[model samples]
Target chain A: MAIVAKSLKYTKHGEPQDVLELVEQKIESPQAKQVLVKILAAPINPADINTIQGKYPVKPKFPAVAGNEFVGEVICVGDEVKSVETGQHVVPLATGLGTWTTHAVYQEDQVMAVSKNVGLAEAATITVNPCTAYRMLKDFVQLKPGDTVIQNGANSAVGQAVHQLCRAWGINSIGIVRNRPEIEELKQMLQCLGATAILTEEEIRTSDIFKTGKLKRPKLAFNCVGGKSATEVSRHLDNSGVMVTYGGMSREPVTVATGPLIFKDIAFRGFWMTRWSKENYDTPERKQMFKDLCDLMEQGKFVAPVHEMVPLDKFKDAAAAALSFKGFTGKKFILDMSK
Target chain B: MAIVAKSLKYTKHGEPQDVLELVEQKIESPQAKQVLVKILAAPINPADINTIQGKYPVKPKFPAVAGNEFVGEVICVGDEVKSVETGQHVVPLATGLGTWTTHAVYQEDQVMAVSKNVGLAEAATITVNPCTAYRMLKDFVQLKPGDTVIQNGANSAVGQAVHQLCRAWGINSIGIVRNRPEIEELKQMLQCLGATAILTEEEIRTSDIFKTGKLKRPKLAFNCVGGKSATEVSRHLDNSGVMVTYGGMSREPVTVATGPLIFKDIAFRGFWMTRWSKENYDTPERKQMFKDLCDLMEQGKFVAPVHEMVPLDKFKDAAAAALSFKGFTGKKFILDMSK
Candidate 1:
């Protein structure tokens, strides 16, 4: 039987509130090696917004469906599919799955059958932000017990995830954020997530972090907001430490003084989850990383917070709410397709 | 009986040609656990110039002798000394034993005996430059047969050492130098040292190396000249590769664009021989490194090209010869301390 479904599509690239449209389309039967999935819940992530606006490198083919991560239930299997059984919940491995639809079809290998104990909303937010945070910490620098890492944009989803993961690994973290009027409240929130210390960008700039002295310096620095924030983080690292940059939210270029590279021997590196996942698809290390993350989630060491659930017809409203500063205070907006 | 020795001493820090004085003094008896050595040969390296200017870190307490590396003969040993025999040729194991005088005293354990097979000139230059080249290649990056490494200052002592060692390991090297009137002669000289490709800084900037769709890029870049040369080398690296910076000849500073660090995930690092040797002293690894370097030298894989040999009294002529800008040439000015 044909499955008639509706999907949120973008005809042109722009702000999420302006370009997204909900339209009915015919979902064909699964081809060989494909599995048809009913997308049960999907979260609105910052990367998803960037993907829709065509700002990110991993852009979907135009007139594209624009969602990277979601939780779904397998409704039907193709002729050659045997890995995932019908009626099981799953999450797609990476971007380009376009999960903002009532139903979707993907190759059997591209989907992972999740444990029944994890809730749909939590699973929806797991594949991107948490994985990115975990990989960035573990891959770039070898962190020993009591070793410290510092990062800016400490109030974002990935920042909270990094804090919790570092805590689990017996490492310390210093979080940096912009100086807002609600900084005290923000500090409390980050501390609750296991941040060892929190500071404002202005404080880091005015301090003696750069003047060579015996101060406690971080061994690794995570940067999301570029411009002066990156330069400041570079200054606070010990000799031979690394700075791994993933995002540039301020849309400013990352500038570094040559003295640090020449005198102190610091390293600069980058990380992108979509690119890493795509490149390491068939490697055993990739498989082991996924298994490790799943184990962490099963042990209750990791958690994904959902801000609000919106229906498919209210997709535009959901996108706006996700992008709005007022509604998404430490919460991720999820789309529930059941309605 | 005391040894009557003539030594060069600097009463105060000043330019190499100005304040240095040659004086005759009576050498005291060797203390317990000390050995007296007669200096044979030493090269006036760039670091020596910096030392005489009092610009190097580890400055001598004033009125001090000024060379760091040399070949010498053990003439006498203190009553308590056991390991080193008198009349054997030895080299100081880098530090505290200034090598600029006719006769000096040191602890028996503070020296390494050189084989009769290796010439004194070769042993004089071995302690720093060749060891740096070896450590930088092996310690930081994993090299495989057919992998390419590019470096600036190809005519430098360290750079020439790298070219020969890379060739021995079946690794390829692309050497960069400043444009000179004797460009053809320079290219031929580097080629004889086993450089696979040679290019001037200007040719690289105006070439198609950075154009899109190029099939080959270097797996590692070694930067001795900072500023524009470093950036140009960085532009030609494959994704996730490393650029190791050890020297800054241009004095213009190493500037890297943020796009490579954020998107391509390249790494930038620095290496210092003084720090490495001091930190890893007496380890089996350090001993093995020296042995390997000696074996390479014995097999004729490494050679120090001396341009001029000067007597101790001709110190001004030696300094001028070392600092001359005669375009693409070998190391100049060796001190024949025996004279």
Candidate 2:
């Protein structure tokens, strides 16, 4: 039987509010080794917005659906499908899953069966930010228990994940954020999530820690907001340390002074979660990472804080609110497809 | 009895031609752990020039004795000295020994006694360049037998050491050099030293081998010239590869494009042997490195290419010639202090 479904589509690339169009489309029956999943929830991440605007590398083929992650229940399974049974909840293992629709048909290997205990809202945001934070900490350097890391954009989803993960591992972190009027409240929030020290960018830039005594330097630095924030983080890195730049929110290029690179033997590298996952990795290694993340989530050490939930029909208004940082205090706006 | 000695001293920092002076001064008896040695042979290296010009960190308080690596015979031992016996030949295990003098004093632990088979000139050049090359190859990365490394400044002392050591370990190297009139001769020389390929900088920059995919990209690129050459080498590195910048001869800063760093996950780091040895490591590691270097030298995989053996009186002329790139090829300019 043909499954008639409603999906959010955009015929042209532009701002999310201007281009989003909800339309009815015919969903085909599950092909061989495929499962038909009914979408439950998906978050509007910054990367998802970039993908919708055609700025990200893996943009959907035009006249396409727009979403990289979502949590759903398997309604039907192909004859060849055996691992994931019908009525099981699953999430895509990667980006470009086009999870904004009412239903998606993907190969069995593309989806991971999530635990029943994990809420759909939390599961929806799991594949990107948390995975990125986990991989960056684990892959870049061999860190011991007491080693420290410094990161900018500490109030963002990935930064909070890093803060919690590092805390669980007995590692320390210095979190950097822009100075806002609610700086005290932001600091308390990050501290509750296990940040060791939280500082404004201006405080770090003008700190006397570098001038007077033996400075405490981080072994690794995580940079998301590029531009001068990257430079400021680099100053607190120890000799032979590495700084990994993963995002350019300020849209300004990351720059490094030649003296530190030459004299102190600091390394500069970058990380992109989608690109890293797409490259071949050992199967056992990936499985272990997922298990660890799940364990952390079950223990309440890794929690996804949702600001608000909006029905599918309100996506345009929700997306606009997500993009605008004027009044939001936490991770913003999840789309509830069940409505 | 009054112990008196004649030593070469520089009262002020300047060009090697103007400041070096021979002065007679009374030598004090060795302290409890110090030993005096009669100088044998010391080589003038570019670093020695920098030291004499007060550019190096460990500068002597002037009327400063200025020489670095050298061979000597133990003339007197302090009461507690146990490492060396009178009439034994030894070389300093570090810089700042001031090997240009007729006699010098050092702590007993500061010298390494040499085997009878190693020549004084070979021992004189052993401590710095060869050790730098050896440590860089072994300590920084895990290189298997079939791995390949590309290096610029192929005719340099450190470069020559790297070529020979890599050959001994069954690793391949592509050597790059500036264009010279005797380019063929230089190529033949490096080939005899076991370089798999040698290319002029211009050839490497514009070669069809890189563009047409005829040659494999190197996993490691060793850069000495830090301008466009380093960036060009970075372009030819494999994904997740490293480019180590150890020198900047062109005086132009190393510039890296953001795309490769962001997309490919390439790493850029620097190596300064002196700073690394002095600040980061301890005495036992230094001894182990020296022992390994001596073993390589004994196996004939490491050779100190001496350009000329000039007497101490001709130091000015030799220094002038050593500073210029016009003539005299390969490693050291030996100063025979005994003359």
Candidate 3:
């Protein structure tokens, strides 16, 4: 019998809504050591949009499937498959798996079985954003308990993940966000999630950390929104501290005054989860990072961000929502393949 | 007999020419563990000017002497002094001992004996600029023989030192300089010192490394000129490479596009020799670096930059020339105390 798989495919690089299309394919049974996975839920990440728009460094070949990560159930396995069995939930062992689909065929080692205790949305979205946060925090500065980290984009998925991780590690965090009408609500939300202090962009500019003596100089800075926000956060970093830039939401360059680099010995570095994962593929450290996140999720210490689930056929709507700049500012759009 | 010393002194921070004054002081005999040294030659470095203007991270106390480094001869030794005999040449073991005066009293350990084979000019300036170049090249990047490094301000003192060191290590260096009337002459001068390829600022912006491919992507970049020059140099760095900023001649911030940080994993850091020396004081590695540089100088491979020797009494002229924006662009002004 022939197995039919439905997927979102893009033949060329352009705007996601302009290039992405729904397509169907016929698949034969898995070959030796291969497993057939029926995708359950996949999130539409900003990186996924950038990939479709050809702005990201890693791109798919032409006439290729579109999504990078997902949670799926093992439907069938080849005769030689042994690590995972049917009905087990798993995620792509690495990135670039074209996860926005109804089903996929992969080699036995291409997926890792995850605990079913976490919800499908959390499991599906765990590989990228959370991993990025985990690596940047753990790899850049060695933070001791009571040490502080300051970051912008505090409400972002990775930013919230940093807050939760900091709380669990007994570290303090100062979160900065843009000025908005519901600033208090946003601050309260982040505080509930364990941010020690939250401030709007304006407050940080005229901050008197030396005068009012609110917080110590942050030992580390996480910059996802480059521009004035990134600069202000960097200005507060302790001597010889490092600011890791993983994303630039402001569409502006990372601007640093020459004084800090020469006098205080501050360093600026970039961290791309894709590059880090590929360079350190299948290391025990990476495995431990995932296991830690999974355990946190299972223990109800970390919850997935607010998200809207849409059926695969409604991809255009999902793509438009992911591309929208206004509503659902902090929510992810997940493709509900089961629908 | 009273040893009367005439020295440039600054009572407060201001323009070098406006605030610096010639003051006469009576020098005392060498105390226990102390040595009296008569200054021979001292280079007026940009850092010395910055220190006078109070713009540098290190500032002097009021009523301070005006120079940081110099070469001198041991005139007498105290009872406990053992490192060097009378007439032995030496340089300061640390910064902040004013060197522009005719004589100084230092603890025996405060000076290191050096070979008279190298001229006083090279010995006077060795402790700062050459040490900076060596530390930056060694500390930031793990450069191997045959690897390539790029830098701007190719005719400056440190730049020439970098070229000589790279030649010694069998590494290639692409030098970037401004467009000048004597551009070809400057290029030839640097080439004689061992630059692989020299280009003007415009040439670097339009370099055909992407098309004609004359040079490999540099594994390291030494940026003293910040702003666009630093960014352009960083653009050509190999993936995961670093750009070490020691100075910012343009007086602008180091601006970097976000693309390289996330896509190529390029890093930006600053190097202050004072900070490094203070932090790694009395380490064997630092001693070895100094020994290696001294050997290179004695071998006649590393020569000091072109300079105009001015008498110590002509302090105003030397300070004025050091502050001048034109004429003698790459040449240092040395105080000739013996004259």
Candidate 4:
């Protein structure tokens, strides 16, 4: 069967709202090793916006699909496909699977059969930020129950995931965010999401949580906002700690004093979700991660990020909203392709 | 026999020369596990100066001896001392054993009997800087014989050792130093010691050594001078490369861009010779490191750094010269305590 599917496509990199256009692509039957899927929801993540702006590492050729993550339903499978059958909800096992479309055909291995237990927004963001938080916490340092993980940009999508996961896993978390007029409300929101403690960037500079016996110094630190914020988060890490950088929202560099690096034996490293996904796809570890995350959702211990759902046709407004943190809304934009 | 010895002593933290005083102390005979040694030469290392100013991590109480490294001749050993015999030469096995005195009694195990094949300067300086260069090269990355290492502060004492050791190990080394009026001369000198390529900091900012096939982008980079210099050295590291910082000569924090750190998988870490020595003090690894370094010295593959030997009474002048770059002289000041 042939279907006319509308996809948000970009011929070249530019502003997401300026360069993206709705184009109709011919969707054919799944090849022998492929499966056809109906995309349900796709989020305009910062990485996706960066991809449209040509600022990300993974760039597809011209006239490429405009999104990298989404949740979809498997419509049908080809003769050689055994991974999923009809009516199964699925997502890409790795990144670079453009999801800003009504329908598409993908090779069987590139798609993961995710459980139907998660909500549309949670499942759509399963592969990027959540996986980043998961892998960084698991891979870099071993955190026992009650151990702490400190992070900056606690209001980011990844940070929200980190908070929930840390809570579900019985870990303590200290969050660093910028001081704002509505910070107390934001703090309350994140605390509900599982943040053990929250402090503004300025407060972290003078916070003696470690010294005053309020919280154990973090053995692991995650950084998204760079510059002075990154350094301040690093300063509170425990002896022989590890600080991992996953993003630079502040657009500044990570600066580290020689004292902590030398005297405390602190190690500085970077984690790229795209790279980690590409390397670990199809591995048992990746499978276990999805299973665990889905189990968390099934148990109602995990919830999706705060988001505003938009129809596919209103992608321009979604893109603009994602670009401007629009009045510090703390809300992600999920394009509801089902409409 | 009782001995009257002149020792450089400091009572409190201040400038090295301003606080140091030559004091006469009567030394007693060796205790059961002690060896009495007559000091030969002690060079004023930067760490020693920092210690004198109470800026280093390992600071002694007030009225402490003034130096950290020296070579000495064993004058006598007690009945239980099996490490060294009378007339044997030795150096401290680790830091914090002050070495400025003409004669002192040391616990037998605190010193290592070194071969007389090395010169006074080389033997006196065996425990710190050279060991720093040696351990950093061997520990971080496995560079096979033909692999390369790139480093800044190439005219530093550790850099000189790194050049010679790389030569002996058949590894290529690229040096980055400041561009000066005598740049060519410094380049020639380092090239003689075995730098595969030499570049000024400014040239490295735009150099294409890696791009032009002049040298392979190093898997290992050594950084002593931090800030932009550290950033430039880090920029040339190969995929998943590691940069180790041992000294912050510029007194600036190490700044790293999020791009290389995330995309290229570069890692930033610090190396402290004091920490390494303290951890590996009684281990076979320490013994093997010293043996390998001395073996290189014995084969004439390593030479003493450029130095000026001053009599013990001229200690203040040596301290002054050590404090000042004074026309950027590379010659280290060694106090000839034997006189």
Candidate 5:
């Protein structure tokens, strides 16, 4: 049987508001080794908007459904389906799967089963930001309990996740953010979320945190805002530390001094969740990472970033909020498809 | 007994030419586990000049004998010395030992014995540039025969060494040089030394070498000139490749785009010969590297960069030439201290 479901679709690449349209998408019954999924919630990530604007590196087919991440319920399974059963929660193993539709039929292997013990919004957002934060911390320099991590865009979803995970894992983190009018409020929020310290990017370069012995110097730095901000974060890195750049919200390139490179031997690297997902799709490490993250979430040691939940009919409002976001600020917008 | 020998000395840090002067100093006879060495030849490397200017990180003591690298002949050994015999050639095992002096007493372990079959200039320069090039090639990536390497500052001594070694190892190389009036000459020289292709920094960004299938894209990029030059060299790297920054001749910080770091998973790393020496001083890797480099030199597979060999008395002119060196151009200036 074929089922009609509401979906956010775009036939041309342009501004999300200009091109994205809500249309009825007819989804067919699951084929052998396929499962029909009912998307429970999906977040309007920046990549989603970038995909619509045609400014992103990934070029999906035209007349594409929008969204790259979602939490869905397996509603039906084909005769030969064995990996997932009806009523189980799942997350897409691969990225760029057109996740905005109310329902989708995926190959049994394309989805990874997830526990329903976590919050709907938290589950919806796990596959990208948290995974990125998790991998950056684990795969780069090994972080011991006493070691510190410094990162710009500390209020970003990934940064928030890093703080929570660091706390859960007994590691210390100093979050660097731009000085803003609500700086104190932001600082308090991050502190509550387990950040050991929060400072402006300027303060990080000449902070008393390490000088005053309040915190150890960082061995890993996360850079999302490039330019001087990236340099400042890297400047605070300990000898032989690594600076991993995952985003360039400032649209500036990363700049590094020649002195440290030659003398201290630091490294600059990058991470993209889409690429990581594809590369590690069948790896045991990926399964263990998700398992660990979910365990943290179930224990309430990890929670979704501060976000606003909207019913699917108000996706335009969510897209507007995403576009209106200024420099890693604002709450994430997640659509509740069941509404 | 004591030996009186002349050396280039600096009482304080300032302009290399202003602060440096040739002075005759007395060297005491070898103590227990020490050897009296007569300096043979040493090059006025950029690091040596920077140290004199106080711009470099490593600070030698005041009234310091200038020069960090040299090839010397062991003249006498104390009773307990076992590392080297009298008349054996040796190079400093550590940087900042002040190698410009004609005669000095060194601890037996402070120097590593070297074969004297290679040319004086080649051996003199080997402890730094060739070692740097060799390590950058072998340490970072596991490049094999037919693998390609891309590097900026192709005319640099290290760049020249990379070209020769790549050829000897059956690896192809593309050397990126700035567009100068002598561009064709520079290109021809690099090619003659076994560079598969020589492209200008601008040409590298859009070169047909990889597009036309003339050469494989480099898995490793050697960056000496930073800023836009570093970015251009990094642009042509293959997926998961690394750009190792050794020198910043342009005095501009290395600038890298976020796209490659994420999409291609490329890396930016730094290599400092001094740091590497300290870490690997007593390791078999260090011994093997020097042996490998020396073997190549003796086999006529590797030769020193074009250089002007100045006598010890003409130290001031060599200092001037080193200071006047413009953006990776000009020949190396080596001092034949035995003169």
Candidate 6:
């Protein structure tokens, strides 16, 4: 039987609302080594919007479907499919799979089986931000249990993931965020998620934490927001420490003083999940990382950030909401394709 | 007979001329495992000035003698001293030994015998600048023959050493300097030392070397002049390349765009010769580095930078010249203590 799939696609690069349109395609039954998946849920990431505008490094081909990550269920499998079975939940094994469709056909190697024990929101958005957080922490400096880590964008999805992972590893974290009216509320929320301490960008420079030696200087700093915040975060790192940049929300360059670079032996590096996945797709280490994240989610030790769900037809609204900096700036918007 | 030594001493941090004084002290004969040496030559490095002004990361104790590196001739050795014979040349094995003197006593373990085949000037200025250049090239990047390196301040002492060493290693270098009145003369000098190309800072951004692919994007970049030069140099690095900072002549911070850090995966790190020597004092790697440099110098492949020799009594002039930018900016000044 043939499956009629509805997808959000763009024929040209422009604003999401102006260029994205709904299109129907006939997806045949699973080919020799293919599987048919019914996408259940997906999230609208900032990178997705950038991709639509052709501003991101990873550009899609013209007439391309939108969305990078999602959680789906296997409806049918070809005779050669041994890694996955019908009625199994899975996620894209790599990036640029275009997961915004109601139904799609994929080669068996393109999807990996995931445990259904994870919440829909957590499983749908798990492949990108959480994986990025995991790699940044694991691949950079080797932190001992008592070692301290500092990061900005404390309210970001990746930052929250870092907090939980650090907690699980018995490492201390000092999270930094911008000052807002609900700063107190955000601080309390982060503290509950296992942040050892939380401060705004302004407080970071004046705080006695670095002076009193009560908390050792951070050995690793995660920078998602650049500009002055990146500089402030990097200045507090211990000697020979490294600051890894995975995202740039401020659109500013990373600045470091000569004193730190030469005297303190500080280092700066970058991490990209898309590149990592593409380069290491066939490695056992990548599989192990996914297994570890799923295990934590199933144990309730890690939870997805605050999210609002919208049905597939309301994707334009979800995209607009994700792009807005108005009320609830920290929450993610997920499309419930099952609806 | 008691040996009377005249040494420059500083009791506090201030201008080198104001705080420095020639003090006379009695130096006794070599005791048990000790060797007495007559200081020969020491170069006036910018770091020495910084050290006197208490602006460097390494601070000396009060009432400290002035120089950090020198070449000296062994005059007398105790019964237990075996590392060097009388009339042999040696340099300090550790920093802060105060080399600006007529005579001083050192333990057998405190000095390393170097080849007299090297000239007095080359052997005297060998420990810091040459070692820094070597370490910056070897430690930060795994460069092979034909690979390209880019650096600013290509007329500085360290920069000259880099040009010679890259020549020895068969690596290509793009040397950047400021537009001086004698720019052509300076460029010819660097090219004779094996620099593949030399340009002013203003020409770096407009250069087509990176885009033409005739010269591959540099795998390693040496940044001595921070600020705009550092930014321009780093922007041209190959993917996953590193820029190692050793000095900041411009007294400005190193700034890099967020795009390169995340999208191109360029890295920035620092290299301090003092730190590396202290941390790896006992390693075979340190010994091997010295051997490599000495071998190159002995082969006439590496030569000390152009220098003007001033007797100890003319130290005031040398200090002033070393601190000036108008005349002999690229030349080093050495104190001929023996004369």
TM-scores of all candidate predictions against the true structure:
0.87, 0.82, 0.97, 0.96, 0.96, 0.98
Top candidate, metric TM-score: 6
Q: Work out how many backbone clashes candidate 6 has.
A: 0
User: How far is A321's C-alpha from truth in model 3 (Å)?
Assistant: 0.8
The single-chain TM-score for chain B of candidate 1 is 0.93
TM-score of chain A of each: 0.91, 0.93, 0.96, 0.97, 0.97, 0.97
Q: Name the 10 consecutive residues with the lowest summed lDDT in model 3 chain A.
A: A207-216
The 10 consecutive residues of candidate 6 chain A with the worst lDDT sum are A321-330
Compute DockQ for each candidate against the true complex: 0.35, 0.37, 0.84, 0.77, 0.81, 0.86
| Model 6 residue B243 distance off true place after TM-score fit, in angstroms | 1.1
For model 2, give the interface RMSD.
Answer: 2.6
Give the lowest summed-lDDT range of ten residues in model 4 chain A: A321-330
Pairs that collide in candidate 6 are none
For residues A244-309, could you state the per-residue lDDT of candidate 1 as single tens digits? 887777767566555566557688778888778888876887777667767777777767753688
| Tens-digit lDDT string for candidate 5 (A1-339) | 778988889999998888888999788898899899999999888888888899889998988999988999999999999889899999888778888889988889989888899888889999988998999999999889988998999999999999999998888988999998999999999999999989987676676788777677888999988988998888888899999999998989888888888788889999988888877889999999999999999888999988988988888877887788942563798888855
Against the true chain A, what TM-score does chain A of candidate 6 give?
Answer: 0.97
Q: Write the per-residue lDDT of candidate 2 for residues B1-339, one digit (tens) a residue.
A: 355666668988887778887777787778788988878888887777877887655578777787888888888889999988888889886667677877888988788788746776778788777777877787666788877788888778778888888888888888888898999999999988878888998998877555556455677888777777777777788877888877677666666555567777777887778786776445677778777777877766677864678887787788888877422246468888755
Give per-residue CA lDDT, model 5, range B1-339, as digits (tens): 768988888899998778888888888788799999999988888888888888889898897998988889999999999879998999888788888888878889989888889778888888888999999999999999988999999889889999998998999988888899988988898889888888887787776788877678889999988988888888889999999999988889888888888778899999998888888989999989888988998998899888888888888887887778841563888888876
RMSD of 2: 4.6
DockQ sort, best first:
6, 3, 5, 4, 2, 1
* Poorest stretch of ten by lDDT in candidate 3 chain B: B321-330
Residue clash pairs of candidate 4: none
Badly placed stretches (over 4 Å) of model 5 are: B326-330
Q: Could you give candidate 1's per-residue lDDT for residues B1-339 as a string of tens digits?
A: 779876777877877778678888898888899889899887777777777787666677888877778888989889998878888888878674667678888888788887757777777778878888898889877888878788888888888888888888988888888888999988898889888878999887776643543325777888877887888888888888888888777666666566677678777788778778888878888889888878878888877753466888888777766656321245656778865
Let me know the TM-score candidate 1 reaches against the reference structure. 0.87
What candidate 4 gets wrong by more than 4 Å, as runs, is: A326-329, B326-329
Model 6 has a DockQ score of 0.86
